[model samples]
Target chain A: MFLALDVGGANIKASVFKADDAFALRSAKLHYPLWIRGVDGLPKAIEQAVALLGCDLKGASGVALTMTAELSDVFRDKKEGVDKVLRKAEEALGSFKVVTNDGSLLDPDEAVDRYMDVAAANWWCVGWLASLFERDCLVVDVGSTTTTITPVVEGKVAAKGLNDVEKMALGEIVYVGALRTPISSVASIVPVNGLWCRTSSEYFANVGDVNLVLGLLREEEYDVATPDGRGKSVEECHERLSRVVCGDRNMLRPLQTRLVARFVYEKVVEKVCEGVLQVLSRLASEGRYPEVGFAAGLGDFIALDAVERAGLRGVLLRDLLGRDNSIALTSASLALYLAYKTGVDVGRWISSLR
Target chain B: MFLALDVGGANIKASVFKADDAFALRSAKLHYPLWIRGVDGLPKAIEQAVALLGCDLKGASGVALTMTAELSDVFRDKKEGVDKVLRKAEEALGSFKVVTNDGSLLDPDEAVDRYMDVAAANWWCVGWLASLFERDCLVVDVGSTTTTITPVVEGKVAAKGLNDVEKMALGEIVYVGALRTPISSVASIVPVNGLWCRTSSEYFANVGDVNLVLGLLREEEYDVATPDGRGKSVEECHERLSRVVCGDRNMLRPLQTRLVARFVYEKVVEKVCEGVLQVLSRLASEGRYPEVGFAAGLGDFIALDAVERAGLRGVLLRDLLGRDNSIALTSASLALYLAYKTGVDVGRWISSLR
Candidate 1:
């Protein structure tokens, strides 16, 4: 089984699978956050990731790391920066013959160009969409902190060579998310009785927080950003958001805060939906629409909201999660899978570049 | 003669006077960013705002709006929801008839509660350190996306907030800054050593990108989000990066593309000496810990940076900035003038908030 990990700025998810003809999945996905690493939490977080890996990863022949780490900071020379990544990954992976953007699987030759070709967005899973259709496709993978709209003609991510930091202000990489995004960033002042008063933009307010308040994010099914700033937990979220807008706790109340929060959530989602629609419209103008494919690690709300709102159709990410109930790999997972199936050594493909 | 407008998520600024004195300065400061009208480069963008005001604020006011606009996003809530800011400010300011958090004119409102009881983090500036210090006090307004470690303790304007959609990630009073920032959410990144790698959970990066990359941004700077499928600029970013990384420019580079694109700008600045050190650090930390004072605007980087690196000083911001730039002010020019005269708000009261 080839183990693929779709590591994004906000999420680190894994799926174990055997992908020769049919895919068999193993393991429940774990979604942790990149929020409070605070210079001291890195080791523990990595340890958690390792433990999670230990739970499902067994008898895996190879491992590929699809990450948003590349989106973290800029390098003087992007290519040279890629080399630094390989070294860090090498250190982190310990014995894993980790892949690189270079053609060589493991060696770090002085090939700056050869090593800077790995593609990752906030929703890194979208990388897998490259395998879905051979024709042109416009991939819109929206995740926490940002949404990336990549134009792929015949299977490739199209955009500037920007990491997550630089991409935050750009449009294709909208800096909003379903579960973890803060609310104040979405709207400076939401219309309240048309008076145009100021609002408190605290981390307490987010798309998910409002969505959850509005019944959009169900506690029973959705994966939420941890209230305590770790991997999400169902019980914890329910407890955290049980307050009503009227300041009542546990019991719900129909008031401004609740209504406002919910409406804002819907509007934020709508804004993104509109953004995707705009992107798709532009793609149509250029003939880059693939037989649409839908996939995301999120529950039905975001994807459904987006698809219904955007009115695009394709396979659901859950179904094509590639052969397993295994931590359904995101699109990036699918992209990596296809890369492997095509006799392309993704590690070599990445490392051998240039 | 240059009109510097700091349009923050919280306050709308128009400076007619150039740091001379209160009335003599001729700067008429009013509150703005009360509530965000729209994000489609409409109502809030420069031209729209001019029309919305129903007046030609041009030559009369040196028409400028300093904004934390770059701190905006589709998915994230502004650090301060554009709601409840003014009301809270009114309430906070109303309680304090006190003339200064600065030790100058002790208005009836200058009681400890008036100066110390902050309503929200946004009006950190209203505390008025400028009215408290006898000399030029440096202001280090460190909030979410960026940190304006300005040397406001003194008399010169020293920094600006312009890069990485700096205003958006800083605070929401502008409903545009950071609420609970994730390390990955700070700026974009690039892989190093030929692999896709995240920044160290430890001390890997800094705040220059969020506020210092593109110089100080004014209301006039507005770039359209790249057209989704037809966005040539995004494509160009892709091509440039792909060529560097050995990936095909015509196709999506998958996982690395967005991350790469996002990191491009921030990475470029990383190489510049200023990118790493906004100002000399040791020079700041070892000085006589001043009661930091910030200017009342989004572009107050110089003063804030000076205080942040100063280490020994108490931080402050203006009420104008949504958050960060913690020195709050009832009036920008007047507050500073009062602060310069008497240094009353300058207290020996130190805490371990840092």
Candidate 2:
């Protein structure tokens, strides 16, 4: 049995898994504004998350970790952020392993020397796990503020870009996602009253509001705060979406607001589809194409819809991992990959836990 | 003998023009960080600008006003911004006629009653002025933070959309300019080290840095503060542009930084060109195409380049208004339009000035 943790800017996710076969036994996710709370709260948050998962860390064989928290604004720079996160992880889980951008696992000491490799490298573990299922496949993980599109080939992670910056350049990482993305960043012009109205760049609304208004996201899944600090009611969502075009709910009818939401949804899907095509085209140029796509993250539906729109085959991570385990897919994958790569006796550890 | 003021979010421009034939006499533009200084600085800034033009506002026959300052964040909302600007203009220039979105002039009281018409309506004055020269033309004004592309037909402003939001919806306005526009807002991917890299979404640099590095803008014309609060030297511009890809001067060579700047410049030009094409396509569908493009604002060179790239006849605003007067072209246009529309005896006013 191994504990895996995925720490992000906005939330922290943890999972306990039978690492040998990548079977997640339990998982928990907690929202923690690391940027506001600072790195000091990370350890407590991790403890609470692990407690919710009912995991006995001392009895675990080892811990695996991947983080995007280093990119959060809490730290002055990414290097400082990485170092601080590594120190906190050490305090919480001694002698743990870190998943890196190069699809390798490193111990804490080596992680510090190769800090860039481990910084915001959670997607790499997901890509590696996806490759294990199919030799030729794409891993599409749409998180709160970004989307990662990684191509796998011959049961190996095949990516031209190593880091977020490089991946963004390669069109493999889109700076748009399900919940926290500002709607102004998605589509500057939206359809309003049968005309395309330019969205106010004031960040009065975000993608969460769009999805909420469109009924694509459940009320409970609306985990983030609204841009206007309003409730997550459909009426409030409409009001927020209306403000994207500098209109209030009173000025725009509910139907008009719904149209605005639809436009934003379509634009985001189009963006993801464009990224998918770009990655596939790059692979095709190398005489390879992803035969299937694995969709993960909170915005998995978006990825599934984009895949179908792009005329590609796709499978939801929940369908593959089971619904209860899907929420911690990235963390589970990190643990499983670390065990496989490091030759950890995860099966024996699972039996001991029983 | 008439003074015109065009106040925007970033700068305040003023000009003195002859009422007859709309000939410009003198003009001045003063960079004022209205968003930072707040509306409280407006009176002093306007006085300084008028003083720089060596004009006597008290002796003027009348003052014409148009403003985008209402959209600045200094005010709680557009209404308050407009009302405050009107009050300031009344205090500074006595009884002034304000330009409205309908291309007509109104007194201060009527302007308040129709505040929406007066809010950010400076573009209307430019479009009206452009229509005077060529009935079928496109006025492409690239300001510091936004671009306005207004279509004229048969010597009339034939805009499908009114106001900034409406024009933006019509593709007559693009939220990109030659300066002060964030570089990340231009393109997510930029060329780096002979490969594409995703630029850091942080506001580490802006279009001003891009143009500064490329020599398109003179050092003095880099009027706004940089994203990193650095100077506007070529070396500093390189450093700022490098930060767009999350690098500094130490990490990237000067040549590499230049490539980044060039990429951003191309992307901005492409955006403006796309807006121009969209507007032209709409006109073409209506059996009318702009025969020429009138380029104005601080980014006239960019507009000229885009117009040529779009295969449209281009004329520089400086050519029409003269080099010295072009700095305040919008203000001069407002003054001329007010005189033309109100039938003000500008020849008498010029004689009085003499």
Candidate 3:
């Protein structure tokens, strides 16, 4: 059995596989907001996540780790952030394998030295999982705060950017996400009473409220804090979204606020679509074409929409992996790869999930 | 002696004046972030502010209060928010006089009953202060999170908007402020390496970093938390500003990041200028032209820039009032007004500050 941990800036996820099998026996994701908790709290947070997974750390044959938490601003830079996160992870779970962007596993000491390769590389596990399914494909993993678009060619990860800065420039990472994206950042000007009004620069509302108001997300899916620290009812969502334009429900009608929400939602979709097309064009120039696009994580539907807009066939990764496994795709993928490396019947195990 | 309180959504300010004098003996402003503390913590926060002022709440002859805290999202609606904030203030400082937008003072129960009149009326104090100097003038108070443009005509306040919603629509309130404004909200697309790159919707950078990079604001002025929770050094500011276009320091050169910061600063200036024009035109239509523009608050320089762009004689309220008093304009204004109403030598006191 192998245990995998995907530590992110805003969340921590854990996956545990059954003994001598590729099947994920248990998986859990929790919102720990490492930014607020600071780097020093990371070890206790990891312990809490392990407890949530309800598995004994000693029971696993090996522990595999992949992390994007270094991108969080608690550290001065990504290099320091990676070193600190690795140190804390070591304190929580002794001796583990860390995954780099190029799909190589390294010991903790090596990871610190080659911090740039290990920093913000959580998307690689998804690429590895997609490469196992198809030789030439693109995978988009949309979490709460960011989306990563990874391309695979000839049964290998073919991403042009190994780190965040390069990935952002190459359109491999689009920062708009399913939740926590400030509504004002999506569109500087929004239509209000037949006039385009400038949005407030305050963090008054986020995409989760926009999605909730537009019915794209259920209330339960908006598990993060509402921008106003209020409840997640549709009425409350409208009130929060109205503040994007510096107005409240008392100032805007329900239909008007809904119209604003729809506009923001469309802008978010356009942003992701822009990133998708940019990545595709970059790949096309290199004579590397993807046959299918795989969508995973909380914003799988968003990835699928962008893929369809790009005129490519799209499939939900959750349909191939189990629902729980897909939501926590990075850890699950790492665990499954470890199982396969250890001579488990991974192909049959994935077929069982399907 | 009188103690004045100006409670806001993100800050709580207190000012203390000596008996029969408009001179502010002591005043202070503290960042409380009511959304995080909630309504339950308002009384404690107010108590803390009073302590900051170095004055005993019971030693004051009377307490005068003007608040914009009701607009905070801790309560269900403005009415409930007003009631709760007033109740908390009463709990903190005992009985006090509440000032409404129309410049009327009432007891706590009456203020709650007329919540709409009292909600977000902190601008009235600034207007009253400006009217004392010039019969017809426009006063722009730019605080940390928002700007309020108030007009005083013929020695009386002449504001078209009584509350936040109307103020936003009428251009009396521009939600962009000196600090805490997300950079993405100022401009959706920024010039990045000769190509217009769409900004990331994440709260990666804010206006504070832009001003810091441009030398438009002193480092001490940027007291708010940065979007990345990093240090306020120029290099760190450059790194944060670069991320506005989804790029980091490694991807963008120093000049490139500075270019983005300049672009964002110009956009912020344009936004405030647009609101200034909107308010000026509305006044012109009503034939209530102001002869001068008075600028105040932490963003006094920003207000002066907007005033100059509007082709008006700009004067910093800090130059007129003492520097510390103008920084806490609303609370100081309230205390001075109360002293004047209670038979103080307000005219000589104004000259004393000058």
Candidate 4:
């Protein structure tokens, strides 16, 4: 069995996949404010995830890693962040292979030299895994703070952008997602009380509250803290959304706040659709159109809606990988790729460990 | 003999005005990062402004204060911020009257009780001053981080919104401003190499660099540091703007970067124009249309452009108040109002001090 880790700015996820059946044996996720607290808290976060997964590094054949944590403000730059993460990962797991955007794995030493390729490359691993299943498809992963749109063609990842900056320029990365994104970032002007009102730019509410009020987010998926430091009740969500228009629950009717939430939700859908069309148009100009869209992430409903709105066939990763595996698909994909590359046989590996 | 102080989030300004001329005898502006460093730096900043204006507070008849510094993140909330500012101002100048959004002055004790009115009411002072010149006109004051659009009708400040949140909801406040505003906040898509490229959401460059490149901001006006912690030279500005499109000076031609800067400038203009039209439409519905626009602040050129583009007559505060006084018009207005209210002939008051 191989253990894979996906370290993001806001979360840390781990998965252990057994090569015999190509299935995840265990998985765990933890939320940590890596940006605010810095990388000093990362070691404890990793330990918690490992304990939750009940995994021992001594029993695993090898470790695979992909990370987007370098984009956090904890480090001065991406290079420093990459170096710290690699150093900590080595200390925790002994040694590991890092998955790069180029679809290749590098040892810890080599990964430091090629930090740009390894930084924020988790989405590439997911897209690569999707390409193995269906060629000529678009992978749309909408997470809490961002959305990644990658196209796979002829059983290979066909993305021209390698880093977040390049992907943003190429329309492969949209800085909008289903949660954690401030509502004002979606649209400055929103309809409220029968007229157009400019949304307060304060962090009064985020897209998570919008989705929570709309019933698009399950209680389990509402894992992050509310922007207003309030409870996660529907009434609380309504109150927060009302504050977006500088109104309180008493000042605005529940229906009015719901209308505001619907407007924000539609704006997010429109933004994702715009990203999809941009990527699709770039591919179509080369006479290559995605046959379908593979949706993942906690905000998969947004991707599903965006795919339909963009006139593309939609496929949910949850349907293919099951709900539990879908939640950790990025790390699981890294594990599967590492297992194949290392030619590890989980049945015999477990027998040896026993 | 009256010294007026306008403490803002980014700068502290002071002016001495005489009642007979209604023109400032002396004025000074000092840049201070109040938000980041907090209220602990306010005393030194005020002292610097007072020295620059060559004023002796002990000799002055009284002091008048208007502030937007309470909106800064230095304090926990508006109340705390207001109390701190009031305390500092009282410590520096003994006692003073604060201008409020209600177009009235309050003592320090009363000001603390009505903190919301005192919290960012500098714009109200400007609008009240403008109403003295024209009964029906829109006052547009664009600062480093936010824009305030207030309308005056029938010689009264006829603003429907009171605080920043309410003003934001009423379209009387637009968060997009001339300087310090991130370029990505203006437009997500920009032209690069003759193709549409989404600007990086990273704080690579702000509107200051954009204006600097476009020649709208002079070297002296480029007082704040660039977001990248780089130099303020023209070449450096071009490099920062290039990063907004995920390109550097080496990757992008100077012409390409110039194109990006022009796009951002136009977007800022469009946002200010939208605010002006919204406020005008609201007034028109009530059978009151502003025939002229009063432009103030360091970003007066943007307001001038926005007003002309919106098909309204424009009046420059510099043309009316002269160049030196225009820069500190907010404080000068407060001094003028205090002199009129107290019937203090500052010309004789200064002579009596001698």
Top model by lDDT, which number? Answer: 3
Task: List DockQ, one per candidate, in order.
Answer: 0.01, 0.02, 0.01, 0.01
How would the candidate models be sorted by lDDT, starting from the highest? Answer: 3, 4, 2, 1
Error of 2 at A56 (Å): 83
What proportion of the true contacts does each candidate reproduce?
Answer: 0.00, 0.01, 0.00, 0.00
Writing each residue's lDDT as its tens digit, candidate 4 over A1-354 gives 788998888878888876655444556677777877678767777777767788787888888998989888878999998999888877777788999998789998999998998999888777777876677898888888889988898978888788999888777888998779999999898655425789999999999998988889976687777898888888999999989989898787666666567667767876776677667656654556576988877788899877765557898877766655566777877887788688755334323322
lDDT tens digits, residue span B1-354, model 4: 788999988888898874544434567788888867677778878888888888688877778898888887778899998999989877777788998888789999999999998888877767777877777898887776778888999988988888888888676888987778999999898655425788889999998898888788887787776798888888899899888878788876655565567666766876786677667656754656677997877788888877765556898877777655667777877886778678755334333322
How would you encode candidate 1's per-residue C-alpha lDDT over B245-323 as one tens digit per residue? 3444454342334333334332222212122122322222233223443433333343333223222243333333233
* Pairs in steric clash, model 4: none
Q: How far off is residue A335 in model 2, in Å?
A: 58
- Tell me which of candidates 1 and 4 scores higher on lDDT: 4
The Cα error of candidate 4 at residue B50, in Å, is 83
Tens-digit per-residue lDDT, B201-309, candidate 2 = 8989999888888788988888887887878899998898888888887887766676566557767876787677667656654556566988887888888877765
Off by over 4 Å in 2: A1-354, B19-23, B342-354
Clashes of 3: 0
- Summarize candidate 1's per-residue lDDT along A160-260 as a digit string, tens digits: 33544444433455566666675566655532321233455445435665655556556643465554453334333333433312122334222334434
